[model samples]
Target: MDAQTGSTASAFPPGFPWGGAIAANHAEGAYLTDGKRLDISDGFPRGIKHEYDAVIDPKKCYPTHEAIDFYHRYPEDLALMREMNFRAFRTSINWSRIFPNGDDDEPNEVGLQFYDSLFDEMRSRGMEPVVTLSHYETPIHLVG
Candidate 1:
């Protein structure tokens, strides 16, 4: 409701581009699957609140490690988005997914394929993808 007029807004404008957004480190799991390797986010069990773990702890849970399993379940997830009339989606390319070690001479083929399939799937569903090159999760190999 508008404070001045005490009227409620009808709805968003047509073609307003309803959609969703996700960061790779926050959505995609499979941190070590395919040719992928550890990223800066891999060691942080509690996000940025505490210092990053020197090594991954078996007993500690890292949210990113299995976050919604988006890596393997994107088709299902995208279908849900399509059902909601989504016309756009914002997501990131995991830096380590492409360059597993962050300094590899060549990009990982499997990783490249995954994103290719993901983008293609999004387009197939009539959703325009807005991609972020990275989302602060640098490859762990490059951090140390």
Candidate 2:
């Protein structure tokens, strides 16, 4: 069976929403900077030898210190997406970027600035930006 030979039927109306997906810990790299506190995802051990067991050890973990380095390279990244004629981009914002330390008197300005620029770039490129508040990596302080 081939997808090209499959029957075609209108499952829904046209103009449906379609986009890519990304996660905080898997994308954002500002793990413990700019007032951002460590989250449980940071504590999850990486490179597990067994594929069917659960392991949680902060000491043995390797946090995504520069996962894609999107924080500093978002402009270029957005440009690449624009080249692809993306109608929308789906990404998650780091909770720590907004509420560093989990609870604070106010949100961090530097963190906010990055997002502001990102959104502006997306709009300027004629692409809509879809944001997820917390796909993962909730500040450990929020656990209790």
RMSD of every candidate to native, in Å, equals 2.8, 5.0
Model 1, runs deviating above 4 Å: 1-7
Distance (Å) between predicted and true CA of 129, model 1? 0.5
Best by TM-score: 1
Prediction 1 TM-score vs. true: 0.91
Model 1: per-residue lDDT, tens digit, 1-144? Answer: 888888897678988888999999999989899988999887888545867886988988888889889999999999999999999999999999999999999999999999999999999999999999999779988878
Worst lDDT window (10 residues) for model 2? 49-58
Worst 10 residues of 1 by lDDT: 45-54
Per-residue CA lDDT of model 2 for 1-100, tens digit only, reads 3478685654535655445566767877767767667765665546754332123344564545557777778788878887877768878778777787
Candidate 2 Cα misplacement greater than 4 A, ranges: 1-14, 49-63
User: Each model's TM-score, in the order given?
Assistant: 0.91, 0.76
